[model samples]
Target: MTLPTTEDRDPQSIGLSAKPDEEVLAHILQRQIVALEAARDAMPQIAGAAAALHAAAASGGKIGYAGAGSAGLTALTDCLELPGTFGFPADRMRILYAGGAKNLMTLAGVHEDDSEAGFKDFQESGLGSRDVLIAVSASGTTPYTLSAVQAANDAGTETIGIANNADTPLLREATHAVLLKTPAEVIAGSTRLGAASAQKAALNMMSTLVALRLGHAVRGHMVNLVADNEKLRLRAQRILQDLTGCTPDDAAIALQNAGGRVKTAALMLLKNLDVDTADRTLALHDGNLRPFL
Candidate 1:
Protein backbone atom coordinates (compact mmCIF):
# COMPACT_ATOMS: atom_id res chain seq x y z
CA MET A 1 0.00 0.00 0.00
CA THR A 2 1.18 3.52 -0.69
CA LEU A 3 1.93 5.54 2.44
CA PRO A 4 2.49 9.17 3.33
CA THR A 5 6.09 10.38 3.54
CA THR A 6 5.93 10.38 7.31
CA GLU A 7 4.89 6.71 7.24
CA ASP A 8 7.59 5.59 4.83
CA ARG A 9 10.46 3.41 6.09
CA ASP A 10 13.87 4.96 6.62
CA PRO A 11 16.37 2.84 4.61
CA GLN A 12 19.16 3.64 7.08
CA SER A 13 17.26 1.86 9.84
CA ILE A 14 16.31 -1.25 7.88
CA GLY A 15 17.32 -3.47 10.81
CA LEU A 16 16.53 -0.92 13.50
CA SER A 17 15.14 -3.45 15.98
CA ALA A 18 18.31 -5.57 15.75
CA LYS A 19 20.70 -2.64 16.07
CA PRO A 20 22.88 -1.89 19.10
CA ASP A 21 21.60 0.64 21.66
CA GLU A 22 24.07 3.33 20.57
CA GLU A 23 23.24 2.84 16.90
CA VAL A 24 19.49 3.04 17.59
CA LEU A 25 19.91 6.24 19.59
CA ALA A 26 22.08 7.69 16.84
CA HIS A 27 19.39 7.01 14.25
CA ILE A 28 16.71 8.60 16.42
CA LEU A 29 18.91 11.63 17.01
CA GLN A 30 19.42 12.01 13.26
CA ARG A 31 15.64 12.04 12.80
CA GLN A 32 15.38 14.76 15.46
CA ILE A 33 18.00 16.81 13.61
CA VAL A 34 16.03 16.45 10.40
CA ALA A 35 12.85 17.49 12.18
CA LEU A 36 14.48 20.66 13.46
CA GLU A 37 15.81 21.39 10.00
CA ALA A 38 12.31 21.05 8.61
CA ALA A 39 11.11 23.51 11.20
CA ARG A 40 13.85 25.93 10.19
CA ASP A 41 12.86 25.59 6.54
CA ALA A 42 9.32 26.66 7.42
CA MET A 43 10.34 29.93 9.07
CA PRO A 44 8.89 32.15 6.37
CA GLN A 45 5.48 30.64 6.88
CA ILE A 46 5.85 30.88 10.64
CA ALA A 47 6.64 34.57 10.34
CA GLY A 48 3.53 35.19 8.28
CA ALA A 49 1.36 33.27 10.77
CA ALA A 50 2.85 35.23 13.66
CA ALA A 51 2.14 38.55 11.98
CA ALA A 52 -1.46 37.53 11.29
CA LEU A 53 -2.00 36.50 14.89
CA HIS A 54 -0.46 39.76 16.11
CA ALA A 55 -2.88 41.76 14.02
CA ALA A 56 -5.78 39.73 15.38
CA ALA A 57 -4.61 40.30 18.94
CA ALA A 58 -4.34 44.04 18.33
CA SER A 59 -7.93 44.01 17.13
CA GLY A 60 -9.07 42.40 20.41
CA GLY A 61 -9.31 38.95 18.90
CA LYS A 62 -8.73 35.60 20.62
CA ILE A 63 -6.31 32.80 19.68
CA GLY A 64 -7.57 29.23 19.28
CA TYR A 65 -5.80 25.89 18.81
CA ALA A 66 -7.16 22.69 17.23
CA GLY A 67 -5.50 19.33 16.79
CA ALA A 68 -5.63 15.64 17.64
CA GLY A 69 -3.34 13.27 19.61
CA SER A 70 0.31 14.36 19.78
CA ALA A 71 -0.33 17.35 17.55
CA GLY A 72 -3.11 18.44 19.87
CA LEU A 73 -0.87 18.23 22.93
CA THR A 74 1.90 20.15 21.18
CA ALA A 75 -0.57 22.89 20.27
CA LEU A 76 -1.78 22.91 23.87
CA THR A 77 1.73 23.53 25.11
CA ASP A 78 1.84 26.82 23.21
CA CYS A 79 -1.67 27.98 24.19
CA LEU A 80 -1.34 27.12 27.86
CA GLU A 81 1.94 28.96 28.39
CA LEU A 82 1.03 32.25 26.75
CA PRO A 83 -0.62 33.60 29.88
CA GLY A 84 2.20 32.63 32.23
CA THR A 85 5.06 33.35 29.88
CA PHE A 86 3.85 36.51 28.15
CA GLY A 87 1.05 37.60 30.47
CA PHE A 88 -1.55 37.06 27.73
CA PRO A 89 -5.07 37.13 29.04
CA ALA A 90 -6.34 33.62 29.78
CA ASP A 91 -9.79 34.46 28.47
CA ARG A 92 -8.30 35.13 25.03
CA MET A 93 -6.93 31.61 24.54
CA ARG A 94 -8.92 28.50 23.53
CA ILE A 95 -8.04 24.87 22.78
CA LEU A 96 -10.05 22.15 21.02
CA TYR A 97 -8.90 18.55 20.68
CA ALA A 98 -10.38 15.32 19.43
CA GLY A 99 -12.48 13.35 21.94
CA GLY A 100 -12.94 16.46 24.08
CA ALA A 101 -11.47 17.28 27.50
CA LYS A 102 -12.65 14.08 29.17
CA ASN A 103 -10.43 12.02 26.89
CA LEU A 104 -7.46 14.35 26.89
CA MET A 105 -5.19 12.08 28.93
CA THR A 106 -6.33 8.96 27.06
CA LEU A 107 -5.68 10.52 23.64
CA ALA A 108 -8.14 8.32 21.79
CA GLY A 109 -6.88 8.41 18.20
CA VAL A 110 -10.20 7.24 16.75
CA HIS A 111 -11.76 10.62 17.43
CA GLU A 112 -9.36 12.17 14.95
CA ASP A 113 -11.42 10.79 12.09
CA ASP A 114 -14.63 12.41 13.25
CA SER A 115 -14.93 15.47 11.05
CA GLU A 116 -18.34 16.40 12.38
CA ALA A 117 -16.98 16.45 15.92
CA GLY A 118 -14.34 18.94 14.89
CA PHE A 119 -16.88 21.19 13.22
CA LYS A 120 -19.23 21.00 16.20
CA ASP A 121 -16.44 21.90 18.64
CA PHE A 122 -15.42 24.99 16.68
CA GLN A 123 -19.03 26.10 16.44
CA GLU A 124 -19.24 26.00 20.21
CA SER A 125 -16.08 28.03 20.60
CA GLY A 126 -17.97 31.15 19.46
CA LEU A 127 -15.17 32.12 17.07
CA GLY A 128 -15.62 35.34 15.10
CA SER A 129 -13.78 37.45 12.53
CA ARG A 130 -11.45 38.84 15.17
CA ASP A 131 -10.33 35.36 16.26
CA VAL A 132 -7.44 33.31 14.85
CA LEU A 133 -7.28 29.52 14.89
CA ILE A 134 -4.20 27.34 14.55
CA ALA A 135 -4.97 23.84 13.27
CA VAL A 136 -2.28 21.15 13.54
CA SER A 137 -2.06 17.70 11.89
CA ALA A 138 1.17 16.00 10.89
CA SER A 139 -0.37 14.17 7.94
CA GLY A 140 -2.47 17.23 7.06
CA THR A 141 -5.49 14.93 6.67
CA THR A 142 -6.86 14.45 10.16
CA PRO A 143 -10.58 14.82 9.64
CA TYR A 144 -11.25 16.39 13.03
CA THR A 145 -8.53 19.00 12.70
CA LEU A 146 -9.40 19.92 9.12
CA SER A 147 -13.03 20.26 10.05
CA ALA A 148 -12.11 22.75 12.74
CA VAL A 149 -10.11 24.75 10.19
CA GLN A 150 -13.04 24.73 7.79
CA ALA A 151 -15.49 25.76 10.46
CA ALA A 152 -13.26 28.56 11.67
CA ASN A 153 -12.63 29.88 8.16
CA ASP A 154 -16.34 29.73 7.34
CA ALA A 155 -16.98 31.83 10.42
CA GLY A 156 -14.57 34.49 9.13
CA THR A 157 -11.78 33.65 11.60
CA GLU A 158 -8.34 33.42 10.06
CA THR A 159 -6.92 29.87 10.30
CA ILE A 160 -3.27 28.87 10.27
CA GLY A 161 -2.50 25.26 9.40
CA ILE A 162 0.66 23.35 10.44
CA ALA A 163 1.42 20.07 8.79
CA ASN A 164 4.38 17.96 7.59
CA ASN A 165 3.24 17.26 4.04
CA ALA A 166 3.02 19.38 0.88
CA ASP A 167 -0.08 19.76 -1.33
CA THR A 168 -2.27 18.48 1.48
CA PRO A 169 -5.80 19.73 2.13
CA LEU A 170 -4.80 21.06 5.56
CA LEU A 171 -2.24 23.38 4.00
CA ARG A 172 -4.66 24.60 1.36
CA GLU A 173 -7.58 25.08 3.75
CA ALA A 174 -6.03 27.83 5.86
CA THR A 175 -5.35 31.54 5.48
CA HIS A 176 -1.71 30.82 6.35
CA ALA A 177 0.08 27.46 6.33
CA VAL A 178 3.33 26.11 7.81
CA LEU A 179 4.74 22.92 6.32
CA LEU A 180 7.47 21.22 8.33
CA LYS A 181 8.26 18.45 5.76
CA THR A 182 10.11 16.24 8.25
CA PRO A 183 11.49 12.93 7.00
CA ALA A 184 9.98 9.60 7.96
CA GLU A 185 10.74 8.18 11.37
CA VAL A 186 13.33 5.44 11.88
CA ILE A 187 10.51 3.29 13.21
CA ALA A 188 8.18 3.50 10.27
CA GLY A 189 4.77 5.14 10.91
CA SER A 190 5.78 6.42 14.34
CA THR A 191 5.28 10.12 13.55
CA ARG A 192 5.42 11.13 17.21
CA LEU A 193 9.20 10.79 16.99
CA GLY A 194 9.81 13.14 14.06
CA ALA A 195 6.62 14.83 12.88
CA ALA A 196 5.70 15.83 16.42
CA SER A 197 9.11 17.37 16.98
CA ALA A 198 8.86 19.52 13.87
CA GLN A 199 5.37 20.68 14.82
CA LYS A 200 6.57 21.63 18.31
CA ALA A 201 9.56 23.58 17.03
CA ALA A 202 7.43 25.49 14.54
CA LEU A 203 4.80 26.25 17.17
CA ASN A 204 7.50 27.46 19.57
CA MET A 205 8.95 29.89 17.07
CA MET A 206 5.55 31.15 15.90
CA SER A 207 4.14 31.77 19.39
CA THR A 208 7.35 33.26 20.80
CA LEU A 209 7.76 35.63 17.88
CA VAL A 210 4.13 36.70 18.28
CA ALA A 211 4.70 37.38 21.98
CA LEU A 212 7.82 39.39 21.17
CA ARG A 213 5.93 41.37 18.57
CA LEU A 214 3.33 42.20 21.21
CA GLY A 215 6.00 43.68 23.49
CA HIS A 216 5.73 40.82 25.98
CA ALA A 217 9.50 40.37 25.94
CA VAL A 218 12.40 42.83 26.09
CA ARG A 219 16.18 42.25 25.79
CA GLY A 220 15.70 38.46 25.83
CA HIS A 221 13.65 38.59 29.04
CA MET A 222 9.94 38.04 29.72
CA VAL A 223 8.92 41.52 30.76
CA ASN A 224 5.18 40.71 30.76
CA LEU A 225 5.43 37.47 32.71
CA VAL A 226 2.90 36.80 35.45
CA ALA A 227 4.90 36.33 38.64
CA ASP A 228 2.50 34.12 40.57
CA ASN A 229 4.85 31.83 42.50
CA GLU A 230 8.13 32.30 44.35
CA LYS A 231 10.36 31.25 41.47
CA LEU A 232 8.61 33.56 38.98
CA ARG A 233 8.40 36.34 41.57
CA LEU A 234 12.16 36.15 42.04
CA ARG A 235 12.60 36.16 38.28
CA ALA A 236 10.44 39.28 38.07
CA GLN A 237 12.65 41.01 40.65
CA ARG A 238 15.77 40.04 38.70
CA ILE A 239 14.17 41.33 35.50
CA LEU A 240 13.43 44.64 37.14
CA GLN A 241 16.99 44.85 38.45
CA ASP A 242 18.43 43.99 35.04
CA LEU A 243 16.31 46.60 33.29
CA THR A 244 16.84 49.45 35.75
CA GLY A 245 20.11 48.56 37.53
CA CYS A 246 18.22 48.65 40.79
CA THR A 247 19.29 46.88 43.96
CA PRO A 248 17.52 43.72 45.10
CA ASP A 249 15.79 45.59 47.93
CA ASP A 250 14.53 48.26 45.53
CA ALA A 251 13.41 45.65 43.03
CA ALA A 252 11.49 43.80 45.69
CA ILE A 253 9.81 47.02 46.77
CA ALA A 254 8.87 47.87 43.20
CA LEU A 255 7.48 44.40 42.58
CA GLN A 256 5.35 44.62 45.70
CA ASN A 257 4.09 48.06 44.74
CA ALA A 258 3.26 46.82 41.27
CA GLY A 259 1.30 43.89 42.71
CA GLY A 260 3.71 41.23 41.46
CA ARG A 261 3.44 42.46 37.90
CA VAL A 262 6.80 42.28 36.14
CA LYS A 263 6.21 44.86 33.41
CA THR A 264 4.66 47.44 35.70
CA ALA A 265 7.41 46.99 38.27
CA ALA A 266 10.14 47.40 35.65
CA LEU A 267 8.49 50.55 34.38
CA MET A 268 8.17 51.92 37.91
CA LEU A 269 11.87 51.47 38.50
CA LEU A 270 13.14 52.63 35.09
CA LYS A 271 10.84 55.65 34.76
CA ASN A 272 10.96 56.62 38.46
CA LEU A 273 7.20 56.72 38.61
CA ASP A 274 4.77 55.69 41.32
CA VAL A 275 2.62 52.57 40.88
CA ASP A 276 -0.32 54.55 39.50
CA THR A 277 1.78 56.55 37.06
CA ALA A 278 3.67 53.44 35.94
CA ASP A 279 0.43 51.62 35.23
CA ARG A 280 -0.93 54.58 33.30
CA THR A 281 2.23 54.86 31.21
CA LEU A 282 2.27 51.12 30.46
CA ALA A 283 -1.38 51.21 29.46
CA LEU A 284 -0.70 54.17 27.18
CA HIS A 285 2.08 52.25 25.47
CA ASP A 286 0.08 49.01 25.28
CA GLY A 287 2.30 47.47 27.98
CA ASN A 288 5.48 47.93 25.97
CA LEU A 289 8.61 48.62 28.02
CA ARG A 290 10.86 49.87 25.22
CA PRO A 291 9.08 53.23 24.89
CA PHE A 292 9.35 54.02 28.64
CA LEU A 293 12.93 52.77 28.90
Candidate 2:
Protein backbone atom coordinates (compact mmCIF):
# COMPACT_ATOMS: atom_id res chain seq x y z
CA MET A 1 0.00 0.00 0.00
CA THR A 2 1.16 3.55 -0.72
CA LEU A 3 1.96 5.38 2.49
CA PRO A 4 0.05 8.52 3.42
CA THR A 5 1.69 11.90 2.80
CA THR A 6 3.06 13.91 5.74
CA GLU A 7 3.82 16.88 3.51
CA ASP A 8 2.98 20.46 4.39
CA ARG A 9 -0.79 20.74 3.78
CA ASP A 10 -2.00 24.24 4.52
CA PRO A 11 -2.35 26.20 1.30
CA GLN A 12 -1.83 29.48 3.07
CA SER A 13 1.43 28.15 4.42
CA ILE A 14 2.68 27.32 0.93
CA GLY A 15 4.69 29.62 -1.32
CA LEU A 16 1.93 31.62 -3.04
CA SER A 17 3.23 34.81 -4.55
CA ALA A 18 0.94 37.71 -3.72
CA LYS A 19 0.12 40.07 -6.57
CA PRO A 20 -1.04 43.67 -6.98
CA ASP A 21 -4.68 44.52 -6.19
CA GLU A 22 -5.72 44.34 -9.86
CA GLU A 23 -3.97 41.05 -10.39
CA VAL A 24 -5.55 39.62 -7.26
CA LEU A 25 -9.00 40.69 -8.44
CA ALA A 26 -8.42 39.08 -11.83
CA HIS A 27 -7.25 35.86 -10.23
CA ILE A 28 -10.30 35.79 -7.95
CA LEU A 29 -12.69 36.14 -10.87
CA GLN A 30 -10.86 33.43 -12.78
CA ARG A 31 -10.99 31.05 -9.82
CA GLN A 32 -14.74 31.62 -9.39
CA ILE A 33 -15.42 30.57 -12.96
CA VAL A 34 -13.17 27.54 -12.59
CA ALA A 35 -14.95 26.47 -9.45
CA LEU A 36 -18.38 26.56 -11.07
CA GLU A 37 -17.08 24.79 -14.14
CA ALA A 38 -15.55 22.13 -11.96
CA ALA A 39 -18.88 21.72 -10.21
CA ARG A 40 -20.68 21.24 -13.53
CA ASP A 41 -18.14 18.67 -14.62
CA ALA A 42 -18.64 16.73 -11.38
CA MET A 43 -22.33 16.04 -11.95
CA PRO A 44 -21.90 12.40 -12.81
CA GLN A 45 -20.19 11.67 -9.52
CA ILE A 46 -23.14 13.13 -7.62
CA ALA A 47 -25.57 11.19 -9.79
CA GLY A 48 -23.81 7.92 -9.07
CA ALA A 49 -23.65 8.60 -5.34
CA ALA A 50 -27.32 9.58 -5.25
CA ALA A 51 -28.40 6.44 -7.08
CA ALA A 52 -26.51 4.32 -4.56
CA LEU A 53 -27.88 6.22 -1.58
CA HIS A 54 -31.45 6.12 -2.88
CA ALA A 55 -31.31 2.38 -3.40
CA ALA A 56 -30.00 1.88 0.12
CA ALA A 57 -32.68 4.12 1.57
CA ALA A 58 -35.33 2.06 -0.23
CA SER A 59 -33.88 -1.10 1.25
CA GLY A 60 -34.24 0.29 4.81
CA GLY A 61 -30.59 1.25 5.15
CA LYS A 62 -29.26 4.26 7.03
CA ILE A 63 -27.24 6.88 5.15
CA GLY A 64 -24.10 8.26 6.81
CA TYR A 65 -21.77 11.09 5.77
CA ALA A 66 -18.18 11.62 7.00
CA GLY A 67 -15.65 14.26 6.10
CA ALA A 68 -12.81 16.43 7.34
CA GLY A 69 -12.14 20.19 7.40
CA SER A 70 -14.47 22.21 5.19
CA ALA A 71 -15.69 19.08 3.41
CA GLY A 72 -17.09 17.86 6.71
CA LEU A 73 -19.22 20.96 7.02
CA THR A 74 -20.43 20.43 3.47
CA ALA A 75 -21.43 16.88 4.31
CA LEU A 76 -23.32 18.08 7.36
CA THR A 77 -25.11 20.76 5.37
CA ASP A 78 -26.10 18.27 2.68
CA CYS A 79 -27.47 15.69 5.14
CA LEU A 80 -29.37 18.32 7.11
CA GLU A 81 -31.09 19.60 3.97
CA LEU A 82 -32.49 16.16 3.17
CA PRO A 83 -34.70 16.17 6.26
CA GLY A 84 -35.98 19.76 6.14
CA THR A 85 -36.53 19.81 2.40
CA PHE A 86 -37.72 16.28 1.66
CA GLY A 87 -39.13 14.99 4.96
CA PHE A 88 -36.54 12.22 5.08
CA PRO A 89 -36.97 9.83 7.93
CA ALA A 90 -35.20 10.82 11.14
CA ASP A 91 -32.42 8.68 12.65
CA ARG A 92 -31.65 7.22 9.21
CA MET A 93 -29.29 10.07 8.26
CA ARG A 94 -25.93 10.76 9.94
CA ILE A 95 -23.06 13.24 9.43
CA LEU A 96 -19.62 12.88 11.06
CA TYR A 97 -17.29 15.84 11.31
CA ALA A 98 -13.68 14.76 11.98
CA GLY A 99 -13.40 16.59 15.26
CA GLY A 100 -16.43 14.74 16.56
CA ALA A 101 -19.49 16.58 17.97
CA LYS A 102 -17.76 19.58 19.51
CA ASN A 103 -16.00 20.65 16.34
CA LEU A 104 -19.15 21.59 14.46
CA MET A 105 -19.55 25.35 13.88
CA THR A 106 -15.87 25.77 14.77
CA LEU A 107 -12.72 25.39 12.71
CA ALA A 108 -10.74 22.52 14.13
CA GLY A 109 -8.25 21.86 11.38
CA VAL A 110 -5.98 19.49 13.28
CA HIS A 111 -8.63 16.80 13.47
CA GLU A 112 -8.48 16.31 9.71
CA ASP A 113 -5.24 14.31 10.07
CA ASP A 114 -6.49 11.82 12.64
CA SER A 115 -7.40 8.46 11.14
CA GLU A 116 -7.51 6.54 14.40
CA ALA A 117 -9.99 8.98 15.83
CA GLY A 118 -12.15 8.61 12.76
CA PHE A 119 -12.17 4.84 12.95
CA LYS A 120 -13.10 4.99 16.61
CA ASP A 121 -15.94 7.33 15.81
CA PHE A 122 -17.41 4.82 13.38
CA GLN A 123 -16.97 1.92 15.75
CA GLU A 124 -18.64 3.84 18.57
CA SER A 125 -21.57 4.53 16.34
CA GLY A 126 -23.69 1.52 15.46
CA LEU A 127 -22.80 1.14 11.79
CA GLY A 128 -24.28 -2.02 10.29
CA SER A 129 -24.87 -3.97 7.07
CA ARG A 130 -27.93 -1.99 6.06
CA ASP A 131 -26.01 1.26 5.94
CA VAL A 132 -24.21 3.44 3.40
CA LEU A 133 -21.28 5.65 4.45
CA ILE A 134 -20.12 8.58 2.34
CA ALA A 135 -16.75 10.26 2.95
CA VAL A 136 -15.99 13.76 1.63
CA SER A 137 -12.37 14.86 1.30
CA ALA A 138 -11.23 17.32 -1.34
CA SER A 139 -7.68 15.97 -1.51
CA GLY A 140 -9.01 12.37 -1.38
CA THR A 141 -6.42 11.73 1.37
CA THR A 142 -7.69 13.12 4.66
CA PRO A 143 -6.62 10.52 7.18
CA TYR A 144 -9.88 11.03 9.05
CA THR A 145 -12.05 10.46 5.98
CA LEU A 146 -9.95 7.49 4.81
CA SER A 147 -10.27 5.88 8.22
CA ALA A 148 -14.04 6.20 8.20
CA VAL A 149 -14.21 4.74 4.69
CA GLN A 150 -12.10 1.76 5.71
CA ALA A 151 -14.16 1.15 8.81
CA ALA A 152 -17.42 1.36 6.89
CA ASN A 153 -16.12 -0.99 4.21
CA ASP A 154 -14.95 -3.39 6.90
CA ALA A 155 -18.46 -3.34 8.32
CA GLY A 156 -19.75 -4.43 4.90
CA THR A 157 -21.43 -1.07 4.36
CA GLU A 158 -21.50 0.66 0.99
CA THR A 159 -18.91 3.46 0.90
CA ILE A 160 -18.71 6.50 -1.39
CA GLY A 161 -15.70 8.81 -1.36
CA ILE A 162 -15.90 12.38 -2.65
CA ALA A 163 -12.64 14.08 -3.45
CA ASN A 164 -11.15 16.78 -5.66
CA ASN A 165 -7.99 14.83 -6.46
CA ALA A 166 -7.99 11.79 -8.77
CA ASP A 167 -6.02 8.53 -8.25
CA THR A 168 -5.96 8.89 -4.49
CA PRO A 169 -5.93 6.13 -1.92
CA LEU A 170 -9.44 6.89 -0.61
CA LEU A 171 -10.77 6.25 -4.11
CA ARG A 172 -9.33 2.73 -4.22
CA GLU A 173 -10.47 2.07 -0.66
CA ALA A 174 -14.05 3.21 -1.19
CA THR A 175 -16.81 1.21 -2.88
CA HIS A 176 -17.39 4.28 -5.05
CA ALA A 177 -15.31 7.40 -5.60
CA VAL A 178 -16.16 10.76 -7.18
CA LEU A 179 -13.28 12.86 -8.44
CA LEU A 180 -14.10 16.54 -8.73
CA LYS A 181 -11.38 18.14 -10.88
CA THR A 182 -11.31 21.80 -9.91
CA PRO A 183 -8.28 23.98 -10.58
CA ALA A 184 -5.94 24.54 -7.66
CA GLU A 185 -7.25 27.34 -5.46
CA VAL A 186 -6.12 30.87 -6.39
CA ILE A 187 -5.05 31.16 -2.78
CA ALA A 188 -2.86 28.05 -3.29
CA GLY A 189 -3.77 24.92 -1.24
CA SER A 190 -6.89 26.39 0.33
CA THR A 191 -9.48 23.84 -0.77
CA ARG A 192 -12.11 25.71 1.21
CA LEU A 193 -12.00 28.24 -1.61
CA GLY A 194 -13.01 26.04 -4.56
CA ALA A 195 -13.15 22.45 -3.41
CA ALA A 196 -15.70 23.09 -0.67
CA SER A 197 -17.96 24.91 -3.11
CA ALA A 198 -17.79 22.07 -5.63
CA GLN A 199 -18.38 19.47 -2.96
CA LYS A 200 -21.46 21.36 -1.74
CA ALA A 201 -22.88 21.57 -5.24
CA ALA A 202 -22.35 17.86 -5.82
CA LEU A 203 -23.93 16.99 -2.48
CA ASN A 204 -26.92 19.22 -3.17
CA MET A 205 -27.54 17.30 -6.37
CA MET A 206 -27.03 13.93 -4.70
CA SER A 207 -29.47 14.52 -1.83
CA THR A 208 -32.08 16.11 -4.09
CA LEU A 209 -31.97 13.13 -6.44
CA VAL A 210 -32.29 10.73 -3.54
CA ALA A 211 -35.35 12.61 -2.41
CA LEU A 212 -36.78 12.28 -5.88
CA ARG A 213 -36.38 8.52 -5.75
CA LEU A 214 -38.19 8.43 -2.41
CA GLY A 215 -41.31 9.98 -4.01
CA HIS A 216 -40.78 13.40 -2.42
CA ALA A 217 -41.02 14.85 -5.91
CA VAL A 218 -43.26 14.41 -8.97
CA ARG A 219 -41.97 15.47 -12.36
CA GLY A 220 -40.24 18.75 -11.39
CA HIS A 221 -42.45 19.78 -8.53
CA MET A 222 -41.99 19.11 -4.84
CA VAL A 223 -45.28 17.33 -4.23
CA ASN A 224 -44.37 16.14 -0.75
CA LEU A 225 -42.91 19.45 0.40
CA VAL A 226 -44.24 20.51 3.76
CA ALA A 227 -46.23 23.78 3.69
CA ASP A 228 -44.65 25.07 6.88
CA ASN A 229 -44.20 28.63 5.67
CA GLU A 230 -46.24 31.28 3.89
CA LYS A 231 -44.27 30.79 0.68
CA LEU A 232 -44.87 27.04 0.67
CA ARG A 233 -48.52 27.48 1.70
CA LEU A 234 -49.04 29.76 -1.29
CA ARG A 235 -47.31 27.21 -3.47
CA ALA A 236 -49.57 24.47 -2.12
CA GLN A 237 -52.66 26.54 -2.85
CA ARG A 238 -51.46 27.26 -6.36
CA ILE A 239 -50.77 23.59 -6.98
CA LEU A 240 -54.24 22.56 -5.84
CA GLN A 241 -55.82 25.29 -7.94
CA ASP A 242 -53.93 24.26 -11.05
CA LEU A 243 -54.65 20.55 -10.69
CA THR A 244 -58.34 20.87 -9.74
CA GLY A 245 -59.31 23.75 -12.05
CA CYS A 246 -60.49 25.84 -9.11
CA THR A 247 -60.06 29.45 -8.10
CA PRO A 248 -57.10 30.16 -5.80
CA ASP A 249 -59.59 31.18 -3.12
CA ASP A 250 -61.42 27.85 -3.40
CA ALA A 251 -58.21 25.86 -3.33
CA ALA A 252 -57.07 27.75 -0.25
CA ILE A 253 -60.34 26.86 1.50
CA ALA A 254 -60.02 23.18 0.63
CA LEU A 255 -56.41 23.18 1.78
CA GLN A 256 -57.44 24.14 5.30
CA ASN A 257 -59.69 21.08 5.63
CA ALA A 258 -57.10 18.85 3.98
CA GLY A 259 -54.46 19.99 6.50
CA GLY A 260 -52.48 21.70 3.76
CA ARG A 261 -52.24 18.49 1.78
CA VAL A 262 -52.09 19.73 -1.79
CA LYS A 263 -52.99 16.43 -3.43
CA THR A 264 -55.87 15.69 -1.10
CA ALA A 265 -57.20 19.24 -1.36
CA ALA A 266 -57.28 19.13 -5.15
CA LEU A 267 -58.94 15.73 -5.34
CA MET A 268 -61.50 16.64 -2.65
CA LEU A 269 -62.63 19.75 -4.52
CA LEU A 270 -62.42 18.54 -8.13
CA LYS A 271 -63.82 15.02 -7.59
CA ASN A 272 -66.53 16.28 -5.22
CA LEU A 273 -65.29 13.80 -2.68
CA ASP A 274 -64.68 14.04 1.07
CA VAL A 275 -61.18 14.20 2.51
CA ASP A 276 -61.22 10.54 3.54
CA THR A 277 -62.41 9.43 0.12
CA ALA A 278 -59.85 11.61 -1.65
CA ASP A 279 -57.04 10.25 0.49
CA ARG A 280 -58.19 6.68 -0.10
CA THR A 281 -58.47 7.27 -3.82
CA LEU A 282 -54.93 8.67 -4.00
CA ALA A 283 -53.66 5.65 -2.08
CA LEU A 284 -55.56 3.33 -4.40
CA HIS A 285 -53.87 5.03 -7.32
CA ASP A 286 -50.51 4.52 -5.64
CA GLY A 287 -50.11 8.28 -5.15
CA ASN A 288 -49.67 8.98 -8.85
CA LEU A 289 -52.04 11.77 -9.85
CA ARG A 290 -51.82 10.98 -13.58
CA PRO A 291 -53.23 7.49 -13.01
CA PHE A 292 -56.16 8.99 -11.09
CA LEU A 293 -56.93 11.11 -14.15
Clashes of each: 0, 0
115, model 1: CA deviation in Å? 1.2
Give, for candidate 1, the lowest lDDT window spanning 10 residues: 284-293
Task: Name model 1 segments beyond 4 Å from true.
Answer: none
Q: In model 1, how large is the Cα lDDT of residue 145?
A: 98
What is the C-alpha lDDT profile of model 2 across 253-288, one tens digit per residue? 888888877667767887888989988998876454
lDDT of 1: 0.88
lDDT of each: 0.88, 0.77
Q: Which lDDT tens digits does candidate 1 get at residues 1-293?
A: 97788778888778788988998898889878977899888889999999988998877799999999888988888889888888888898999989988878788889999999999999998778999999999889999999999999899999999998888999999999999998878788777888998888888887788778888888989988877889998998889888899999999999988889988888878878898998999888887888766
What lDDT score is found at residue 273 in candidate 2?
Answer: 88
Lowest-scoring 10 consecutive residues by lDDT in candidate 2? 2-11
What TM-score do all the candidates reach, one by one?
Answer: 0.97, 0.81
